[model samples]
Target: MGIKSFQGKRDTSQTNKAEEQILVSDYMTTKLITFKAEDSLDDVIALLIKHHISGGPVVNDKNELIGIISETDCIKHISESKYYNMPSDINNTVGNNMVTDVDTIDKNMNIFDAAFKFLASRRRRFPVVDEHGVLLGQLSQKDVLKAALKVKGNTW
Candidate 1:
């Protein structure tokens, strides 16, 4: 009877830990890739492909989070414009297509909270910021999975 009670307590403790241990800070990818507003479309595409990332935070010269750019955003622009290999002003085309608004999260936010936001919006990524909304890094479903897999002794 004593052993049974001890086992029950252990199980409860494990459940609580699982529920409480995960936070955004724990799962967020602190090392982030970023883009500038003036960056060319080719530049952004190269960075994304080089890192094999789907998206990243966009920052101003002061490193403040401004927006987010993703493959989806790029495609949206391409489909909307539907003008490839046409003689056009590069600056105007790129400028009009950039995504200028995005959702963000705090580093101290719980991972579950971030997960809920991601699921609700169908957005796979978000920028992680500080108290003043300074860009810290990016958090993605991949980052969360990396953390979770680590916890289970599964290397990412």
Candidate 2:
């Protein structure tokens, strides 16, 4: 009977964590400073510096989430341009060089799942979007960690 009670308590603890209902929308940053695919690399660099972010999401004309641009990507582009004797202004558009294979999150996803995604990938942040892929907000690993810390634990 003691073993049965202990098992039940363990199951209940795991259930609480799995059933936590904190969604991405609850904590995502809504005031996102987004960028356009047509934005030049110099412009993106300036914006990133101004916003104090390592990267920003690339949106379409309709403000739909498409891709992401990171500082690493920019640095690589600049280095390659210099090494290959290519004009930085030429072929240096975000749309041409930005990472199109972006991993995104839906606003309705739970915080636990978001945490898992962060663990499985090295991405610093994710673009949160609507069903139609519209830019809704941004979710960082720190945001996920913050949400995780809010879940009711066995201790408190």
Index of the highest-TM-score prediction: 2
Q: TM-score of each candidate?
A: 0.74, 0.81
lDDT of 1 by residue, 1-156 (tens): 354444444346556556555668777777788777777766777788899987777777778887777787777665555557443356533345557776788787876667778899997888888867688877888877676665643211
Q: Cα deviation of 76 in candidate 1 (Å)?
A: 3.4
CA lDDT of each prediction against the hidden true structure: 0.71, 0.84
Per-residue lDDT tens digits for candidate 2, residues 1-156, read: 354544444456666655557888998998988888788999998988988999988998898988999898888898889678987775798888899898899898987778888889977788998888999999998897787687656522
Candidate no. 2 TM-score: 0.81
The residue pairs that clash in candidate 1, if any, are 23-111, 24-111
Ten residues in sequence with the least summed lDDT for candidate 2: 1-10
